[model samples]
Target: MQDATPSAIRSAGPASLETRLEEAARYALLRRLTPALRHHMIGALQPLGMLAAMLERRSQAPAPDMASITKKSNEMGVLSREATAACVGLVAWITPKTADAVSIADGVKDCLGVLETDLALRGFIAVNEATEATALVARAIMRNVYAAALLAITDAAPGPAEVIMQSRQEGDTQIVSITLKPREAEPMGIGGPSYRALDWEDVEALAKAEGVVLEHSATGAVLRIAP
Candidate 1:
């Protein structure tokens, strides 16, 4: 008797080794960022939880204080707006907007926002010094490569460090540079999300996949993006 059964299904495989490697790198980057992303969501919604409990208690009172209830309602409205904005911003990191172009300054800030808490725990501070220059680059490419570059730089640091992100336009290309500034005096912390920091190879893979040019140096790396 021959047993015939279908094996578990999986998505179509990568077309080439390069494609496989690139996919692997992307997944690795996402795993490394999950903890920080989770923290951000919780932080954004924590206030709402507290306010909800307060409103519930007030509403249940035998003689509800209408004036107090109105004040809390107003407060809740403000907090709701803030929480919504925070969550929406966080979503961009996971699923970027469909627009073909994004502002260099905003892109840099968005990446740092997702990584700031995680980096701080790993003993690194990220500063967005990019000017308000718009670049014809996809958000996904900027995010993945920028994040990988940050991890690579900090991973090489011996102690606390400050990473400054800057961008400029030269001719037909926009250059986003990540520079590392060592901070030996400041103490580094130990508690953070447990994940391997991305390396140069990962950055290269991502850059290749997105058709972006990369220049690596002792200090840092620069990404040259073209429309």
Candidate 2:
């Protein structure tokens, strides 16, 4: 993806939002816009819009060539899917709810699968272990955690990001550890610790909602899903 996170952050600003809204209205009223404002709006919403169109096509089309669709749609399409996944995940379990029986390994893989194109574009190399810590945990927990990790990796990495995930079992728990290697020659100062920490805490909360135990250690975030 094109690091829309920066634009997403800018859009979150009170002043920026007000300005964007006013400019939007101004353009609509005059049926014209300053090139700058037009560019800004395009940068902000194009990915989401394109992704939606692709999704509509996919839903209506039968056995479409997913590889071709994804290949052509590119990063924006991936962003759109990620956004949809996040929205669905939030509504499904972020509120008061119980675990929905799901294949934890499959869920993680599905979430990661969305980012493969972006990862390749960014010149990053990643490997997922052949073994999976398959657990019958809440589908939301797996999706949220894996998505959060991908979001973080995308944000922090500048040149190339290396990702490795290990999955196995411990007694009655299924454990998965994710490790991210940032770009060389500089410390990670992209979004700061607060962003990563908030993502971390959110994953924990997501797991807790599913009655799963989660811990963060030096190696990586450890997920212990009880079967």
Candidate 3:
């Protein structure tokens, strides 16, 4: 998996403060995602470790049962494939795609995959209810805006809630609405390692840098993207 850190900072000589802040926010998002990303990858590979240990014990037994060993081997094979797929999907978030254009549904799904675990820990649930939304837009930009929305909204609410994402096409633009629905519960406490909280200001700066139109509503924020 390639690092998602913005290369523009290294490639471009000097940038305005606005651009710098946007870059900082982008890097902050990646930092915030790192813990959950590592947790997820470790989780996917955990079963394989357990299975290997079990197989080792069985093989060391005085009377080794070939049938049982074969069954365990098959189970390991299935689990290995599943773990590989999960890792691949997670890696794509950081890796650049050959094709920049992506369907709104797919883009939302990918972003949610990265943010969902972290959001849950933060006392929020991210639901990508964006079926039938076929608007094609720049994948990376949309994902950055989505990450910002998920972080900013949760920060503002600071309690148990549901972040719903829905999309629709209006002429040449694709509108992704992230609405917050309240829940009667307290905010979760994720003790220990923590990352910088994403502010609304950060979200605005990121949107501006990516040329995405950002609008805040009573419910949440809306991102307007063009192909």
Top-TM-score candidate index: 1
For residue 209, model 1's alpha carbon misses the true position, in angstroms, by 1.1
10 residues in a row with least lDDT, candidate 3: 90-99
Candidate 3 clashes between residue pairs 3 or more apart in a chain or in different chains: none
Give the Cα lDDT of each candidate: 0.79, 0.55, 0.79
- Estimate, for each residue in 1-227, the C-alpha lDDT of model 1 and write its tens digit: 75544431223334466888888888878888787888999999999999999999999999999899999999999999999999887776666225556687777877777878777877777777885766657877768887877777777667787888888888888889998888876565575346776778888988898888988865788999887
lDDT of 1 at 211: 83
181-219 per-residue lDDT for model 2 (tens digits): 655543333332321223344444445545667776433
Preferred candidate (TM-score higher): 1 or 2:
1
| Alpha-carbon lDDT of model 1 | 0.79
Task: Estimate the TM-score of every prediction.
Answer: 0.84, 0.45, 0.82
What digit string (tens of lDDT, one per residue) describes model 3 on residues 34-123?
776788899999999999999999999999998999999999999999999999866666553334778888888877777787778878
Report how far residue 136 has shifted in candidate 1, in Å. Answer: 3.9
